[model samples]
Target: MSADTPYREELAHALRVVHAASVLTKSVLRSLKNSVSAETKADDSPVTIADFAAQALIISALHAVYPADAFLGEESADQLRKNEGLAERVWQLVQQAQFSDVQQRENAHARLVFPATKEEMLDVIDRGTNAQLKGRVWVMDPVDGTATFMTGNQYAVCLCLLVDGVQQVTAIGCPNLRVNPQNPVNVKVHEELVDESGFGVILSAIRGEGTSVRTMLSDGLGEPCKIEVRSSTGGKEIKDLDLIESALGSTSLSQAEHKAVAEEVGAKWPGTVIWSQQMKYIALTLGATDVMLRLPLDKARYTHVWDHAGGQLLFQEVGGIIQDIDGGSIDFSHGRRILGDNNYGMIATQPGVFEKVNEAVKAVLARRT
Candidate 1:
């Protein structure tokens, strides 16, 4: 065990977690969004069997690896299951919502996510809310790219470990992500030169250590190269550099807000935003693009900690950085979630280039304040 020995160990663990998650995600995404039915969660957002399966796999792994760690996840059956008495508890949490006392479980079958059975439902919910949350707990979003997963496009299985509250590590498995789950940082080129459908990308990062990239086809970890944030003077720092964002297809991001950032920064702004949930950060880390800005669609409901944890570290793991619009840090400690999850927008940029982007964002915030 040398200087990088510990890092290598962590890298391996993070890779393992993401790979497990990717296995789950790929299974779900294979059907695309066609097979599963989407239902609104307590949050009034869509959730599917893919989401349930992905989270279940990650939780199962965490329970096996470190049982005592606290766990916080987005989708849980605990509140919706009857035998577990979750429905009654949730009814209270939501201020007296109602559920049916009618025939249950087996009958609801085909249309619902896995574990539609009463006993299975209880297990899912129990696993979900079972957080004692003392030390090194894991945070997960089984299928972070719900829309993409639903559509059979791109999504991710994200898992991160937090000691006490600080994020220590993050593992992202984009089965459809198109990159190797192996060491992506130095894996060379993309599997498909053109970012088309049917490929997966893997990006992993640990706090303090840099980020790495790999394609799905590559194996055994190639020479891991260190990537830097877009440079300030060279190909990286040309002031108004190439901007990459989602296909403008997902409603999660609003074009009106993005256009404003480009206007303020005077950026050239061009490139396709890789659709994979966690792959967005991988793209930025590898120098595919400069920044990824996400403004909250709903002001009252903030972003989830699980939502950004993997992406945040990937940039930091590489030569990039992510900051709230206020230039303050994003809070993962808040077992509670980001405010309005949408109120605080995101800014992802190469190290030096970020300062400029931040300057532009501040101008917008100052005016709003």
Candidate 2:
């Protein structure tokens, strides 16, 4: 179909699908997200049961709904074979009849053998690693923030419907993290949580149209709450040109040739350090923050599509912009959604000011070397 197709109905449905799966993720994440214990992947990044369960939930649910649609997720064949004495542990978990929460189910993920062997699980997770993205492909990051999720912070069930590399529909399920992370009731539906104040946030955007937020639910998603960019007048307002950045995630930017760019130009405003994931974009698009920067330790080293796709759509639809250090849009065309493909070190801001932002960044880069 063409860009922003009228015939494209799958995006909205997919949004609901992820929200359904997010319910499992939220419950499971809440239980295990607080676990300080973790495992490091070959890439030296932290991964936990939350990531595995989230992937399993998404893949299983997607297959049930649309068995024909191809899927691509992060955990793959390499992971299944790494640990020893893990097979029996997996079988024990899988053989159990009921799952109390997502964590329990995930702890037993090795048991839920699809074809045979743990590598099959990884293959399922890697279904989209090198996906033929030119047609209708479903891109997913079962858990967008592995580290954040491990710390009981922010993370997401990040998924989007990309037709020919253009994002048509975007869905981000930040179950525990707030739309206003500080205020859970920003727009979450009070179905399962039972607390009116603990509303879950769902940010959705239809390309070329606009973005909105509402209660995340399985039965029916509530009405859309329209969003727009609020200006940071260079005064003392937190909402002005200030940004939401993490000292850890910003490591690469600090070592970059232009390390002092943001704090130098934008007056280094106060920020709340929520874990990174789709929620950061939700916060940015929903007026929680004006600018959001991802200055990784190695600007060129670590980056992924699952991290930015949902946020990019939300910010763009809500009148903001996201791009690389050089100001070009991040590419999601690589079906596998790997690093070194598109924009890594990213800067997101309002649409009109990106030109100025780009210049400021370039100026800083030039001064360094």
Candidate 3:
């Protein structure tokens, strides 16, 4: 009998595409500089040229190999069609985009194809608007933190593959994240870290195979190094654990509510607040933070699948755990939104700490109700 190969090709392709997308975004940031502008989406979130261009580039590159796979991404071409100027800007960026590393471009150019025209670029961006939840689907957040990106801080290019609604592969590129975790970059610090040689990381994971990381380079990805969460906090109590949460107030619990949870858990209040959700997952995977919590201000609102899909798998593969407030598995089969009876806020932490953290999260959230 032959052995089963699970998402091997898909994982490789995803890593390559995500690295390319990160390059494209960093280029946009460098070129635009102070001139960067964003259009407000219907949800009132900001969308920039980087977001549109990255989405187009990733979807097109992935589709080149898996033409039959469906895509669900954060950006669509609907706005592009309405505003010709914005559309033109995104198209130009897409055309000029290439792998930052010369060696990577040379190696990937043969297999990955960029959109040939502005029209095709828009179409390629729209192709990711697939709403179906079945079969093989790729979920992407071209630029996970537009606000953070604009500030010249940290952001991520997130990509994941799901088959039958189960996460199979995840690849995320954090362009501004310090390649060396030992000298961790503080999100609160506005000054960007300078590593002229190369200064980013791409983390990837395939189902049951565990997680690995490689430095983002001007030539290609660095050698893969397997990673896992910090060993069980051991004697550390919940209060002693290092925690991370959202820097943005919109998607996370209120300041007072957050404080209560931290106090309840015995951790420091207002524990690290990084703007991007996926980046928080990466932080946990790298053992930068021991716990992450996201208690929605509004329980009825569903979280976009793209926001958490990629990060969830990467963290879990590294011995981390993620569950809704009620401790149920997150349901990704509900198409774009993670909807179900138990769908509530999120709690991601190291393996041994989930139970205690989840209990504290529920206790704090329950008081509000």
Instruction: Identify the candidate with maximal TM-score.
Output: 3
lDDT of 2: 0.58
Question: How far out, in Å, is residue 355 in model 2?
Answer: 2.9
lDDT of 1 by residue, 280-302 (tens): 76566655566777765446646
Give the alpha carbon lDDT tens digit for every residue of 142-173 in model 2: 67766655555566778887777778778787
The window of 10 residues in a row where model 3 has the poorest summed lDDT is 182-191
Sorting all predicted structures by TM-score, with the top scorer first, yields 3, 2, 1
RMSD of each: 9.3, 6.5, 3.2
Candidate 3: the clashing residue pairs are: 101-218, 239-266
TM-score for each predicted model, relative to the true structure: 0.73, 0.75, 0.90
Strongest candidate by lDDT: 3
The positional error of residue 222 in candidate 3, measured at the CA in angstroms, is 0.8
Give per-candidate clash totals: 39, 10, 2
| Residue ranges of candidate 2 with Cα displaced over 4 Å | 1-8, 81-123, 179-199, 217-221, 228-240, 248-250, 255-259, 269-272, 294-302, 335-344
| Model 1: ten consecutive residues of lowest lDDT | 93-102
